[model samples]
Target: MSVALPACPSCQSEDVVKNGRTRHGKQNYKCRDCGRQFVENPQWRIISEETKGIIDRLLLEKLPLAGIARALQISELWLQQYVNQKYKLLEREVQVRPKPKSRLRVQMDELWSFVDHQGNKQWVWLALDAQTREIVGVHIGNRSAASAQALWQSMPPVYRQCAVIYSDFWSAYELVLPSKRHHAVGKETGKTSYIERFNCTLRQRISRLVRKTLSFSKKLDNHIGAIWLFIHHYNASLPANSSCPL
Candidate 1:
């Protein structure tokens, strides 16, 4: 019986031979040409595909990295590396998606996040698409009108032209908003309730978003990238219309 040995992973040669058995009794092989030793199923190989899947989901979904590692019995470090690599690659082309240009009754709100800069806590602003429950944009420093303006500028041309922007009594919205769009900022208008409610959803889903935590981000840049990807997938999962069914 010819024992099945894969081509040398190191040299890609079929002229391979059985070298020995591992401590775990898995068959090990040797490359006749390169003389490099390897196993049909390398120890690292066991987690490679699984690690890729975990990282893919982490990059594409809103799940916590630690949670994914725990569920897959994979190392958190492995997932983090893949997540970071993909994050960097996508960041360049990860401009805002082309959403519907039609006017939306969208609710916009900002949340304060704590990030470390020179050992001091800095604030991060968050803006979300309430209807799809997607994070539209994020900014660093004070959640002021300037910050809001920057966030709006970062949005795709489609989102920038929202018919009506629903926000709380934050003066920043007034200063940053254009005269054409209805930027209502009052309690009775319930302008910001949509995003406020979505905040609860985020708090429940991820410990990182929990307001109680003094540290809100593991890495500020990576966290923002992760949030952007999450919103992309989250919006994808939403119903086609993205709002109450007609």
Candidate 2:
């Protein structure tokens, strides 16, 4: 009598062989066709839709991954994997109504953050539509003229051509922004108060961005993704007709 072997979980290939035992003495197998290895009869937890929805809400709040996992009774590894998948599929473009041929004012600002360690500094550049209070553009990179230019290029074409940009006296703004449409003002002038307040909101809501916090991001991609995710949620929650939806 012969017993049938389990097929490969990844490719569903039957060309599999027993490789070895896992550290916990579970049977491990390797697939010849897909070169994939997995444990036999592995216990996989199925996250319920309700649990996933709860996780989504927690992600937008000022909570750490460990705290979220603990509260949801899920493993940290699984929660991290879920978050990775969620962020990877986020839309890259900001959804907003185009106000072409109109005199629009935009507030531009840059905030500093780090990934993995303090040495790996990353600057988050943002452009906000003054009237709509929508985050119309974003670029994550070093604090340089190239990043400023990238932020400008990321804005919708109409805003880029017609919007008057108000920012601080950062030399990069002077180097990249058009002198005719750019105004570098001090904080006392109140020109950039909108973006400044939004930055404060960002730090308050995103745990990883909170100053003096131990919950800093370990990867740059996830850090940037979290910010964009919150931006989309915020724009969606605004009054109707404020912006287009993606």
Candidate 3:
């Protein structure tokens, strides 16, 4: 039997002509109807948006990379690469959204997790708006003044006009945050209770952040990506009134 011609993927037209062979030797075709060029044998497969939705949901559910692969019937390596690529897109999308000009009562804290293994500790710094229950900013690095500053700087300028700021007696918080706004309070006084509860929520939602769990992150990049994904989902899931910045 003779080989059949393929229609143009963009316009679904068979009015096509041979362009040339790609460097890899696949036959390239050009569509006369849509001016679209495509290879007869594409080197890259297009992943469907439905598959991407499943991946996003699974990620928010705190499934490990291997677990996600098993659920999707794809290789872990592919999922890993896809997540790395998609997360950068998500980060850029988040960065482009307009910042709301809302004064905030912010609570800041840090939680410890490990990358590579338990011996390699990493700190996840988080800032939350007490009124909105929205995670305003996140930073991950060593537990130091620099990391605290990074978290502080990530917040929008509008959020910096806080009525009060609460944190534990971490020296980094005292150094990085403005003295007038900062309150180093004990957990007993309930000053940091909201943030403490948020930390528990994070640990419950993200398996990698849980202590003594087998589903921990092996790479720091993946750790950050996972957290970013969770934060985005969590904020979106909140009620409209609850998520307002002010």
Candidate 4:
């Protein structure tokens, strides 16, 4: 009779030895090759990929953090951590993806949201490709020239050669954007109507962005993370008919 032994998880080596038992009474194994220890039948601390998919769907549905936790049978702290980690990765991916090759006509605008129970307001500055309906850049901070500049700088270099940038008559827009490309117009003139409608879509799809809602973020970090997640998902989910280079 032969007994089957499990391979080391760290190195996938058969050179593993019993190292006693874990606190939970699971059998512990140590890999001689890598000098790493792991427990057999270990309790998983990280969220599974299936749970991540559910989380992504719930986020798009504009569910509150607490509500999502309750629905998934997980702690709010765990869910928050998971979301932050995932969004940070998505942010890096977005930053490194290939930039659009052609020059773009863009629309820029800001939307308001509050963080913390103190009602400290934060502004979300967004730049959208007017023709493609794609989000090109995003910045979150106080409504000031610095935030506007950051938003403008966040845009891909390929988009900076814009034929015209339609924006409202916000002083920050004038201060941060180049004078030659900027076109500050009134909202009633339909210059920035596309971005304004996108703002409404954001509020409808992201619970934390909804005005006058109990789903507001209590921390600035979490608020920013939620925004990144929504932007990445939203851009990926756009219909082919509504995509770039119109």
Candidate 5:
């Protein structure tokens, strides 16, 4: 049986024909209508622009790049480039996310993870919108009082005024978080559970953070860059002008 293929997207005409092959031997296509040329590959099957929304949704919902490649029937590296470029460019234009009205409690916590560095595990401090279950900000570095302060400092200027800040018995949290922000600490405080579970979510969503991966992180910056991509999409999925409900 002959494999059916798509006509050129630009031309929308069957007058499309294979022009030759590239160095990679991928069939090159030419459109008679517009004289435009393209390669017919899985990457082109779904236009990158259109796939950006799907890619964003997948990332927001915590789908790993491997999972996205499998589900979308595209190359993992191709999908990675698509997402990396799309959001990186998107981030430039948008910069940091604007703080939305969040009804849920906010929580902050840091976790110790290893990299190739010759030292002990570094830390990534995350601030989460407890209700929406989205990571609002992440601070990376040593977990000193200064590092902790730096992490919490990265939140959008607005969310720094969250109604409640939940964290473990970390003394540094008490130092920087203001009184009006209600800090829940001590062993008895149940507020840390949400952020702790969020750590598990990150572990599952990102291969680099996973305990067992062929490519476990060796660089802290790469670890943090993944978090950036994760947070951008996570915030986009929520209903506009409000925190994520459900």
Candidate 6:
């Protein structure tokens, strides 16, 4: 009678020897041919659909990555990888309904935040539709005229051409927005109140955006992606009567 050993997972070689037991007491094998080590009948790790659903809900909350990991009983590394994957799949363009009405009112504002270090400042420029309270355009970058131009270009053509814009006395708005349609006003006047209020909503929901928080973003892409993810969810959750589908 002959005894057989399991093949190596990496090299698929049957020339394997029992090396030692894993910390969990699983039988571990080492392949002499490829120097590969693995266990037989290893239970492959899988993130269940139910677990993913929980993760999705958690991500929308103002929770830190480590906090979320601890709450879910999952490794932080796995949760980070999952979050990165979700960010990569996100669409860059904002999803918004088209409005045929001309002279729609728009409120614009910029939110201040930093990534990795406090010195590395990143500004989130936003445009909100006054009629439906939907975020219509967004740009993330330095507080400069170029970024303001990017925000202006991000909006649908209907807004760019016909909408009346209200913003704070930020010089960038004067440089980018159409002079005839743009109205730079003081916050006390409440012209840009909608966008300003939405900024508070973002900070409340996003941990990375919260001031003086330990849950800061390490990468700019992830930071932008997280904001976009929330914006998409926010837009989709709006009342059906509010959005005008194209």
Give all candidate RMSDs, comma-separated.
Answer: 6.2, 6.7, 6.6, 7.0, 6.6, 5.4
Candidate 5 off by > 4 Å: 1-48, 61-63, 90-106, 114-122, 129-136, 156-166, 171-184, 215-222, 235-245
Query: Any idea what lDDT model 1 has?
Result: 0.63
- Each prediction's whole-model lDDT (CA): 0.63, 0.90, 0.80, 0.81, 0.68, 0.90
- For candidate 1, give the lDDT of residue 159: 68
Which candidate, 5 or 6, would have the higher lDDT against the true structure? 6
Model 1 residue pairs with clashes: none
* Superposition TM-score, candidate 3 onto the true structure: 0.74
Taking the tens digit of each residue's C-alpha lDDT, what string does model 2 give over 190-243?
999989999998999999998777999999889999999999898877786643
> In candidate 6, what are the lDDT values of residues 1-246, reduced to their tens digit?
877989887888888899999998998889999998888776546779999999988888899989998897888899999999999999988788778967799999999999999999999999999888889999999999999999999998889989999999899999989899999999899888878889998999999999989999999999998999899988888886663311
Candidate 3 structure quality by residue, lDDT tens digits, 3-22: 66799999999888889988
Q: The CA-based lDDT of model 6 is what?
A: 0.90
TM-score of 5: 0.59
Clash pairs for candidate 3? none
Q: Residues 1-246, candidate 1, lDDT per residue (tens digit)?
A: 977678998779999989889898988888999998888655463567755765676545345677777777777787688778776765522233357777665566666555543343434455656565555665655656788787666655666776466676677877886757746676566767767766665565545556665435668767566555655555555666565311
lDDT per residue (tens digit) for residues 66-136 in model 5 = 88888877788787677556544544111334556664477888877667743557677888776666676
* After superposition, candidate 6 runs with Cα above 4 Å error: 1-44, 243-246
The number of the candidate with the highest TM-score is 6
TM-scores for candidates 1 onward, in order: 0.66, 0.81, 0.74, 0.74, 0.59, 0.83
Looking at model 4, report the run of 10 residues with the lowest lDDT sum: 91-100
Q: Tell me the tens digit of each residue's lDDT in model 4 across 153-204.
A: 8887777764468899989999988899899999888889889998998899
